[model samples]
Target: MSFRSEPFLWIHLAGLAVLPLFLELTWLGLAIAESLVPVWLELILLAIVGIVPIAWMQWQKPFDIFSLLFVALQPQQLTSQQRQILRLFKTRKHRVLTLFAVLAMGWALWKLAVFAPLAAPAAARLTQSRGLGLGLAIVGFLGSNLFLQVPISVLGVLLTSNGQFEVTEPLTPEEVSQSVTVLGFRVGNILPTVASNNL
Candidate 1:
């Protein structure tokens, strides 16, 4: 096969060089390297399958229309403070979101590492046997679900802070004064009412 026809030859070779990353714990590094062919093939196939729906959706609408929808439904209207908030959100870790994401991904990565050794021999056995291959494929299918959570969570964080705010535009002095008065009245209402309790 010509190198040009191998869409993922480079990626496969690169994965080989970096396989040790998954093998960081020396004793747990017992990978049946030969068995990785089916796993890697499944990864490629899954990527294409996953991308097709997104591609179709985008193709159904001009991207500018999608952008317009995004803008219209966005929680806040665009303003200078919103723009600054968005920039801050993009560059900084929303600690609550990032903490949960990292914890979840870290757990999955740990499980993958722990199971890698046990999976190696089964992977080897499956490569040579048809029924076993089907079973392994089912296992691979189930395992892929765990890998998808991280990306989904990341997308959630990105959408939340799409950066629109009311503070950026200047408010008239009269408007500010009215707001202060309303806020002061609202604050004063919080005290306990002795007459109501006596009744």
Candidate 2:
């Protein structure tokens, strides 16, 4: 929490952030290479792309995820309300990033899934260069990850929140805990809440 430890904190976060980026790049690279090479080469490259980060992640967050998994798996004395309270914590969205990501993924999926299926026989006549297919595939795969990032971040937030004790209130603690009313009918609470001792 002090100024001196901030550098180390950011350094670790920076390293963790780099992991997903490498994965996205590797996936897109594989996609581009899919149509160009033999199966064995593809498999070897895929293994390298996938396994290395997982090993790194194991080093980074080795104990935490496993312990959480165990806590979640076995039946516990957790109240039903306590369980619902956990779902309140969600990732905040970035409009610009979300829009750009959607556009990229939509374009990529169209080119790969829709156009490729329709253009199969005509591909030979259409592509002037041998590399176009690979190019499109790479773009498509990367685009998939682009749109996927927000959702993945949301998941990561949820996973990490599970270990925490604080619960944030968007408006006020009182209103947040109150049941939401819609047009005269009580629908439900905006979000469930946990103890505010940490907050």
Candidate 3:
């Protein structure tokens, strides 16, 4: 089956990847509001923590990342071999492990971002203003999901396919032929009837 046909699976995987990030950001924002941290330092640290890994991944596997985005927009028709590779992800064990991996990675990153020497002060400041803290959390959550997590997940799927699928041209609908009905009615058969000169 094509990846597009499995909406539930994609949704599940996305939730697995982003929910932890949302919670982590919310907590970080709350913490930040409570501390006297340098906003510039916090922004710089966040940029380094988030962008560096993604940049490295993009550099290492440019094709995989591009293919992921392409496939996401126009899902490729899978070959039997490609389907076999995808089936592994559908298994209970793999599904559970994937969820765990995403969660573990998020947890590790959150700890790194919040507890690291320079970041610790910034994260501590999140709790000082509840409204601002939550606002930052919401914006961060949406931005990260849209720009970071989703692309990473797509890249993972493309890598799993192992370049087995081909990008086919888009399918177009064929023209329908006119036919006669059982009752002798001309269905979809348009014709001009000539009138007799005498009539």
Candidate 4:
């Protein structure tokens, strides 16, 4: 069925679009996407979904941090002091997340280097029939995208974090303001303070 024709499909697709928001700590969107689909198709679907956002997350350096800032600032909601604390928390959260990503990338790369070489061949064989292979291939692509592309990006983040390379700075005031406006539009008046801050 076409994506638009099926309500569930549309919902799932919409979920995918907002997946980045859920990447605050873990890759929640990717995890959700993985859970919704079959294990056989996980790799391919995940791979396709993985790359750009992961890159965006790492490049941005404070995706979740900014999210928290938006949360605290949006409400008037919180005192400026509270917003400052939230910003501190956001920075800490970013640090924790960065640590986890580094460890995960290291672990995954080790496993991939050891097992991926073998697994890919086996998966390729099981999917001998064109139709089955096509589906399996899609799953594989998603998996690779999720696993490899994301890890690669994380490695870039790791390097940047560790001082081996330079990384882009966090979003500027203008960008933050724009994002705040967008957030208010998406969420509503409870966050009017953040919307006002944007002005």
Candidate 5:
């Protein structure tokens, strides 16, 4: 079901939206708090944000967001040259995922630096804030979004275009499905759980 189609999905999304807001409020409180607060508490809150969504996906695999993202990918039409490009990317998925993982770790470091002050407060929460244990949170945001679209879009482009080369051929539905299936592997290699069926 679409996010707007059903009340439950909407309700679930709306409810989940509050979580980040709560996290933001806590960060704000940390930034402005006068006394040293428990660092573990901040860690736990970040953990909850990461766990809840994945848990939701685990608990409701078919209806989760990944399924929604790939729903329209089945009619994946591609030219013969485009298919060649797809094969090229598929051949080196390990390298691609490695790159993504490295970038993700770099992002984690960025978050730590950004939240450092809150991790160890020196003044009031409003005046000072930071985090010592925010790695999982960095994983949740970047890993999820990065895998969700950036990689998919890259593959999608190759699927629909001949790159600098141009093509002129009438496409068939079966050919399209085959090309889309190839793309599933492209993204699947990066994240098996997210692209399991596509693989």
Candidate 6:
């Protein structure tokens, strides 16, 4: 991977490793607040938090997001056609959409906490700490978005592109020096060898 793409690789991998933990924490929080708020409603809020930011990112920078998953050449290295393709991803809109999405997520968490004040459940000592539960839920949601959402959003863009974007194979050193590759992977296979070769 290029220097620019390396950090994103780490974020994506870390997110994959911790995704289960976050999911469990979120569920535990919901369980604690089951009496105060419907689990389904909380779940819907979580979905909105998770999805809106990604949608905004897609709208703001479609091809730019692909750099998070694949090793893409620098903007200067791209051909006019390639740059034009990427340029299409850019939008004239301001950053307000992304900001609003983040604020909305924070608001949802705040609402959850306010509706279900943190107090120890009278019934079970260990299983019923509303405060701890809400805290965990908040952490899980934030962590999920912070670490995993970019990579997931990139995948979403790629899948929906319907082959509009080009992703080449790992470029040999010789080819790298002489050619301009759009998007490629530095290590490992995005698809099986046979599948890639067939393509």
Q: After superposition, how far is residue 144 of candidate 4 from its true place, in Å?
A: 10
lDDT of 4 by residue, 10-123 (tens): 222233343233222122222221234454354334333443445334434323222222332333333333233223323434455545654554344334323433444444
Q: Please tell me which predicted candidate would have the highest lDDT against the true structure.
A: 6
Question: Which pairs in model 6 have colliding backbones?
Answer: none
* lDDT score, candidate 4, position 15: 33
Candidate 1 local Cα displacement, residue 19, angstroms: 17
Q: Please give the RMSD of candidate 5 to the true structure.
A: 12.7
Which runs in model 5 stand beyond 4 Å of their true positions?
A: 1-70, 93-97, 103-107, 110-114, 118-199
Question: Per-residue lDDT tens digits of candidate 6, residues 1-199?
Answer: 1222323234443555775566555555654734556656655656666555555544544424224345644544433333433333332321333454456545554454454434324223446665666566766775555445444433333332424433322334343333332335443333344223332
Candidate with maximal TM-score: 6
User: Tens-digit lDDT track for model 2 on 50-119?
Assistant: 3333333222222111012113211132223332322232223223333444454444444433234344
lDDT, residue 110, model 5: 43
Tens-digit lDDT string for candidate 1 (1-199): 2211221222222333332332232112223343455645643443344333333222232111101111221212222332333232222343343345334533544455446667665455434543444344334433333223223323333344323322223333333322211111212112134212321
- CA deviation > 4 Å runs, candidate 1: 1-30, 33-85, 88-93, 121-199
The model with the greater TM-score, 1 or 5, is: 5
lDDT of each: 0.32, 0.33, 0.39, 0.34, 0.36, 0.45
User: Which of 4 and 6 is the better model by TM-score?
Assistant: 6
How do all models score by TM-score?
Answer: 0.26, 0.28, 0.32, 0.31, 0.31, 0.39
RMSD from true fold, candidate 1: 19.6
Candidate 2 displacement at residue 77 in angstroms: 40
